[model samples]
Target: MTSSITDVAGIEVGHFTDARRPTGCTVVLARGSAVAGVDVRGAAPGTRETDLLAPQNVVERVHAVLLSGGSAWGLDAAGGVMRWLEEQGIGIDVGPARIPIVPAAVLFDLPLGDQRVRPDAAAGYAACQAASRSAPAEGCIGAGAGAVVGKIFGFHRAMKGGIGTASVTAGGVTVGALIACNALGDVVDPDTGRVIAGARTEDGLHLLDSRRALLRGDAPRPMLAGSNTTIGVIATDAVLTKVQASRLATVGHDGLARSINPVHTLSDGDALFALATGASGRTPGMMTLAAMAAEACALAVVRAVRAARGVRIGELHLPAAGEI
Candidate 1:
């Protein structure tokens, strides 16, 4: 068991990062296409081709999903993904050419990284080119490269967030999640309900609870529009319709709520995509798969923090688990 999203057969993972800018993109690919669904919980979301994923929509599957940083501008990564897929002759055949169905989501990392640098077509293509089924390199990579948590207390007090992945096999089926942990609230351990990664005091010595700070009416720093978002993708080999896949994406949010305190706020764009490869002809049930997917998501959240590395962002340095 690789314990990663790629563990789900028929799916591959890849990343393209700009270390200097502290921004990047992650690509989840299904060369043969995969049934896909998406759920967006946060008020501010930066996405591409999400409407088609709705059960009521026409597109039933997507060839790839892109998770990127750069706010709306990062969406250009999807075009790159499309170009790559088109070159490979992947997509819906509509007469003369095939149009690859690629959906995408983005997070806010500009406040923490080089605001001038953002993911683009080249980055998306690079990520697709690097697609593989091996266990992904977690933390401070891909879209999570510039991610930060506990932003409620403000950027100065926030902790570094990054990409994390988890997977589990149950009832002869595999469920997995790839999480980019970037929220306006604190990250808590679901089991203990204790703050694991969150805002630090102005003195940079102790962890501060976001809810507590808000309750006490202590505001730290403010941000611009689209300054925060958390995005991810959940995958399974079970056979499920678009509606079922969409429902599973909802369940995946439970995993986010478990690990991140006060999720789905107006400030954070919390979103997840559900992909069913249908490689396994058998499944315990949609509910069972959803529950497992939720758990896997929570696991990915913690792994991201644990695997993160300290990132220096102008005057401030956000420490990872080891540094903290």
Candidate 2:
């Protein structure tokens, strides 16, 4: 098990990272259309076509789901995904042309990257062209390229955060998750109840509990006004109604709540999408899927932090600057 979202039969993962600019995008393309639903938990989410994914909406399936950097501005990447799907003769037949349904969400990675040079349509297209079924290149790549976490102590003390993914199969069902771990709060391991990576102490050593910092009412949130977010997608092989898929997304938030301290706040945009291919029989019930989803989500967060390499802050790497 490569333990990536691609473990699901039809899903393929790809990344287009602009290393020089410290920004990029990731695309999760389904070989065939998949039933999709989304849940937005953060107070400042930047999304596209999310409404269409609702149970009552007209769209039934999506060709691809994009998670990108550049915040709201990066939404244009979805246009490129649409173009790619159209060229492949995918999407709903609307007579003259097939309209590929694609939904996307973005995180604020501007603080670490060359904010002016953000992901664009061309970058998105490149990502699709690069799609593959192999294990996705995690860490500081794709939308996670410029991702930073634990900024409650401000930019100087934050740690590098990036993309992480995990997948599992049990009781004849397979579930997977891909996450871009950028947030305003600390990341805690649910199993250990320990702060793995987050705001650092003044000496640049030891993890500081940003949640406690907030409770003290002394922490000045870095780049407040929606400067942080975490976005990603989850995939399963089970069959589910749009409503069930939506609920899957909601329960998936428990993963974030367990892994990210003080999450879904006014300064963070945390969103997760659920896609079901129904490629297998003997699917588990919704509650079971939700529990597994939460586990995958939490594990993915830890993986993202472990895989990430610190970005430069002045003359020092962000991680080293706060090395405890």
Candidate 3:
């Protein structure tokens, strides 16, 4: 009867944060046996567990998945998850030794609030330990701690972006999504359809029309080379094979499109993963169910932006949803 995706069974999430360092990570673990798949649509995605997700990959089950800050450097955090899984005796065959498959992905967050701080291996393990059967915290925490958006014109004009999640259930199948929103477009209110966060002019006003800004030759704005991405995970309790899960992940991108404007840009890395815990066998239409899941995920992205608190970077103000 719950409206959110946490209604799915045996899917748990946890967050580990360091406010002083201003960086953290989150872990999503399948409480029971589950099949998972991933789809990377972005050109600059940074992932470590992708090989394990492919159909051709030898590994079957992923003990845990990590989403963290530190850009490419944060990728090392998987080592900590691996270490913990090894202690638990997970992973494919390797003689008497066991290697835990902990797939992880990260986004670039070095420029939003702090540059020196990054998510480390210990942080990853801490997050994994915190996974539980509660609704995961959203906005300005974990992998989204340093996220920002609307930086196509540079950070000075950008707005604060963070983590968001939403879920939906139909025909006894539940689908949930968790997203770290760090993109080049503005976040909008899904209900009212208004720009809630994004770039602003010096006079303190929104672009009014984002497409116009891209078309107008008003003034050539300096752009950051690689400082954007939105990554997320979608989980369902429907029985699905790895290939079907991967296809579902791709379908989840529709949620991204509904929440963010001008998504999947060259400067942005947008990726989504779909995980299936075999708790339901009520066979539903695959494409129809996937579309509904995507819609719910998109709503969650909007909620994430609405929940963010403003972050100050130098003299410029990175406004929150209300301010935008």
**Number of the top-ranking candidate, with TM-score as the measure:** 1
For model 1, residues 199-260, the per-residue Cα lDDT tens digits are: 88888788877768778888656455467778999999999999999999999999999999
Q: Write the per-residue lDDT of candidate 2 for residues 1-324, one digit (tens) a residue.
A: 458888888899989998668889999998588889999998889999899988998787888999999988889888888888889999998998899888999988776646888888888999999999898988899998988888877777788899999987789888899999888888888897788788888777778788776778864656675689988899998988888888878878899999999789888889999998888854689879999888888888888888888767566467721244
TM per prediction: 0.96, 0.96, 0.92
User: What's the CA RMSD of model 3 in angstroms?
Assistant: 2.2
Worst 10 residues of 3 by lDDT: 217-226
Top candidate, metric lDDT = 1
Question: At residue 107, what lDDT does model 3 achieve?
Answer: 85
Candidate 1's C-alpha runs over 4 A off are 216-222
Question: Residue 283 error for model 1, in Å?
Answer: 2.8
> CA shift at 233, candidate 3, in angstroms?
0.3
Query: Pairing residues by index, what is the TM-score of model 3?
Result: 0.92
* Shift in Å, residue 165, candidate 1: 0.2
Angstrom error of the Cα, residue 232, model 3: value is: 0.5
The positional error of residue 288 in candidate 1, measured at the CA in angstroms, is 0.4
Candidate 3 per-residue lDDT over residues 76-187, each given as its tens digit = 7888877766766666558988767677888888865566678888888888778778887788998888888777676677888888888887778888888888888777
Candidate no. 2 TM-score: 0.96
